[model samples]
Target: MHLESVVCFFAILSLGSIATADPNPNQTGSGKQLYRNRHVARQQLLSTTTRSVPPTQPHVTPAPTFTPTTTGSSTPLAPAAYTLSNGEAAIAIIGATYAAGIGGAVLMIGGTAHPLAAGMIARITGGGPNGDTPEVEIEDSNPVTTTSSSASSSSSAEPTPIPSPYIILFSPNATAQEIQSVNSTLVNHAAPNSLSEVVSHGTGLVVFFKAGINPNQADAIRQAPGVGGVFLDETLGVDQLPSSEQAPLSFASRRSIDTDTPGSPKASVRNPADIKLQSDAVNSLKVISQPAGAKLTELPGYGYAEEAGKGVTIYVIDTGVNAINPEWSSMPGHKDILYAPGAAKTKKDFLNHGSCVASKAGGPVYGTAKNADMVVVKVPRHLHTSAVFTAILEVSNDIFKKKLKGKAVINMSLGHLIPDELHSAYEQLLDSLTAMDVVIVTASGNDAEKGVNDVTHYPALLGPTTDIIVVGAVDNAGYRAPFSQGSGIQLNVSAPGYVDCANGKAHPDTQGRWGTSFAAPAVAGVIAVWLSQDEYKAKLQVEGQVAARVKKMVQDLAYSRVEGQPPVIWNGIDPRGLSCASDHPTGFIKVFEKDGVASGYYDVSSNSTTGGVTENIEQWCLAKCTGPCVSVFLYRIRQSASDGYYICNQYNQPWTNNLVQTGVAAADSGVVFTKSLNRRYCNSPGKTVSRAS
Candidate 1:
């Protein structure tokens, strides 16, 4: 039989016997209209099917009284009336009878049936012969909408978009309840678990929201009671340069050593084995000592106090240190490697940058401050600016809580460009930390290629404010490295940018690391050494004095081969005293002779002695003729006929020969003067003045 003929035959038979029932009193006008529409549609389907073939003789039969059946309960289940359209009713009937002919009645519907349609099929094809019920399979399709509720449900099935992360810093005075209330409001406005506390220091409570806040939402947050500022949390990376260009080790191929293995080498300056490992790599350490002069080929040994950085704690905020590395291990009194919360269980030095940094800062074998305690703060390898802020805040909070103000040093070998509005927030953070007497050392950044000044580099740019020490990079020769950012006043001091340090590998390569990342830690290590000293410890006891004192001491004791350049950092070990020639007074030179006439030289100031005086006037010149003192005059005043005392006079202007003097009378009256000379006197003539009589 043709498919249409079979379909028409089944359609007519099923429709001819559909029992009519009383109209549903609960149905509304729309429902009644829908029922009528379905009935009309069935009639059209029957007419179309019949025209395709000779119509079967109409067999008129009385509609059978519907009898309901119950499986377990005595109450019979009423048969439901279906409101399917004509096409749908025909498909159901064709499916049922076709399956019945195949010995097992199996009806397959194109889409899920409306509940009423399912009942209608069950009633039409009662249980098959021998009571074996036919199988019904529903192939999923676009939902059939026969009611308003079905349409409403289909519209609600779309996926929700995810929110982005943001950070909000609350005012310092915001109470816990107020903070909680604000958090509650934000949570209700965004997805669940949207607000989390990033840091809660004395300055403010920093909270992070994963709500992907819109401008209006951000404005709402800004206007909230007690809220200080709202910032979009942005991603950042380690300050270390990309390995392919400048870094020695490829980050992708970097390996981590198993520190748990037996016989691992531990770093200890006193240990013979540890010292041997460091003997070959002391160029960076050797260069930091004494004044910058001839290049050093061999290690003169790092001159430092035995205390090294004993009680000081260096918090390295970077990729995280390899705590298992022997460099951090085996220290007797100060071997504990502290970690911030959420950083303990992770692979500590995944990128190798952090380990190298920490090693240079305080590693026993390779660090400048070999005995310092270390706190490793592990941020993401692909660091975020918010994470950096949180780390800094956490360290500050930790130091404050532990009363480690002067003893704590934070080394940030990382930086990124942030929005202008955030600059104040950063300054406030550093200012707050410095106020607590903590020392902060940061890299000037390796952004020379960007052709921008360090003013664009943060934290480092904040160096001018005296709250932080910004360190740039220098080569082994003590000249500023080509890649080091900032010069002159932009940098506090420079350090060896390239160095051999632990890289967390089993067999670390000899290719030394390079970048301001390494330079920063070297200065930090020296700061640790300073903090470890008894004098600095006492001086730093005064709150807010650490940064200023450290800056002055580092600069005063720095090694500068060139006169105008910012000096490279020195560890204050065997400091070379200031040289008058090296002082390089712009237009002044050494006085070749001291004539017994004081008229030409301006007697700016004088230093005299009552006791025995050795008239080495050059030493006096070096002492008194510092800044702005252009000339010095040695004077001998007769206290008695035979005894005389010497006086040293300093002048602001160079002495001139035109001023007349009364020869021996001025000389007898003890008026003798020396004129300021140029570089020619020191370089060519090499003349010397006789001691005053």
Candidate 2:
């Protein structure tokens, strides 16, 4: 359908449905009839007011030029009187009036007093008690219609008459000359076709005919040899476009702000193998956890204590960081920060969201990795997925061209649900970046309502890949924040997303903000610290193995606690687990569960390596116990061969590595039995051994 027709159809439909409660009894006609009459009168007014152009010539709108203006608030224009057609008096009302609240009065317009139409009075009064009052009372229950011609002129008038342009799509092989030839032949010599200066290259051409395209003409154009398809050229005004592209940013004053002095990391670094929990949340635990209630400085290594993130470049794809501020400028590697060429250098964060996130990642006082350098890629404050995709591609291309693959980590705390068509392109771009060994971290989104219902947010949903880490927000008590959106296989971890905006130097604003947005940067900063480590860099140098092991390494070191389910607290920088690990399946475990007993088959080759390869599990259990108790099959995989794997009881208590054997069941006579392929052979898997049933 044509856009004009569609709009008109909706307008008509809307006008016909206009209803009000307790309409004025004095009203002359139904709203629909009155509105139709007003519309007709408006059409007459437009015909008399507008200047007509030559019918044969195609009208072209000039490109608009914008002049920057000082930012300030302005008062709105008040409604004024306008003369109606048929030389009738039209009283202009500034606001609203109701029937019970309004009474008939002399409507003075142009030095003359005229009695108001019942329709006009009913519209203005909105079925209220009569009284002598000029004051407009706009009730929430019933809206009053102001009879200001200037206000309703545009809405009531008919759209301008113009020949609708057609977008003709040509086959790929069709040349420009052939398209032009077809265009020329489509219209007669007297009525030439008006082709747009902007060509669709090998695809299509926008053509407009003076006489307008009839059904026969359209059919003929469609049947043309190289023409693939034809569509209406639905055009919009420059003003109708999204304001993000048109608006100019007004940056904060260029003055250096206070810098956050660096602090020391935790005294001892923890090893991943020491952590035994394997819940989804455990993948993101830090050694010195961000305390349930503690300042950024108080949290263990929260202030980039680990390697200062040196040699690691954090590509922050956000509202560009306000590096002009001393908090960023005072940093050791602040000089490394960059904005895309030709991008506005107003090193001030207008939205403050970017600066806040950047601080969490690398700002000296507020950051997790104070020493890590950052590339601030300024995007629109209100991000569009396409703009984000473009920015990522550009940054990724730069990283590849400059050979900064494993040396960098990309922090994208912004994303939205996009169309299905864009998903493939978006994922492809991410795959390309990850394939280059760049670590990607993104938020699970703040839309918890949508998330609980299984609405997956993108980029976070882009993978089953280990290269990208999807983080969600967790509270001080280590439970998913009520506002955080995440639950499922895609959620890689959770972190302390809470930040007191009032306390931090990076965000100089009123109150604070929370969500997965803040949580993502915390993870990114830790990755930056990991990247800066000498050992991790050495592992990066040998092929792309390090990128594949990042997820497992994170899970191993994660500090886990069970809420409804376990929530992992993302503490900053665990240097212990940043080792090269392979994905070879080295061993298997057989799970045996009956009654209240939940135990898994645990066996491995004597030579099988620990912490790197996948440990498979085989399950065999009685049908009754298998239904509920077997649902949770968790067996601790110990580092020492002597520490045999054990299972959690029906009570969900932590089981001892070896002594917690022969579990008790809730029902009498239902014996809970547990066994494993002796811990001695686990560390060095000599051969695959079968467990005796």
Best by TM-score: 1
Candidate 1 per-residue C-alpha lDDT over 306-402 given as tens digits, one digit per residue, 9 for 90 to 100: 4567788888876556665656653322543333323444645655667778888876556777667888776543334455565666676667666
**Candidate 2 TM-score versus the reference:** 0.42
What tens-digit string does per-residue lDDT give for candidate 2 at 1-693? 000111111000001211221222112222222122110000000000111123333323221121111101121112221212222333434342211101122343323343432112212322222233332221111123333232232233222223344444454355556565455543321122343222321123321122233232344466656665544432110000111211122111121112121222232343322211111111122322432223323222221233557777888765556655544664555444344322345766544556666766765444556567777676543332323433554566557555776778888776543333333334555665666677888777655533342324445655343357878776544555555665666677777655532122343432244666667787787777777766555644445555566665555545433325334544433333121111211112233333433343322111113323233321111111111222223334444544433332332222233323345432211223223222111111111111111
Candidate 2 Cα outliers beyond 4 Å, as residue runs: 1-306, 335-345, 381-386, 449-455, 501-511, 538-542, 562-566, 569-693
TM-score for all predictions? 0.53, 0.42
Each candidate: what lDDT?
0.49, 0.40
- Residue 257: error of model 2 in Å? 33
- Which numbered prediction scores highest in lDDT against the true structure? 1
Clashes of 1: 2
RMSD of each: 30.1, 26.4
Error of 2 at 304 (Å): 6.0
Error of 1 at 637 (Å): 77
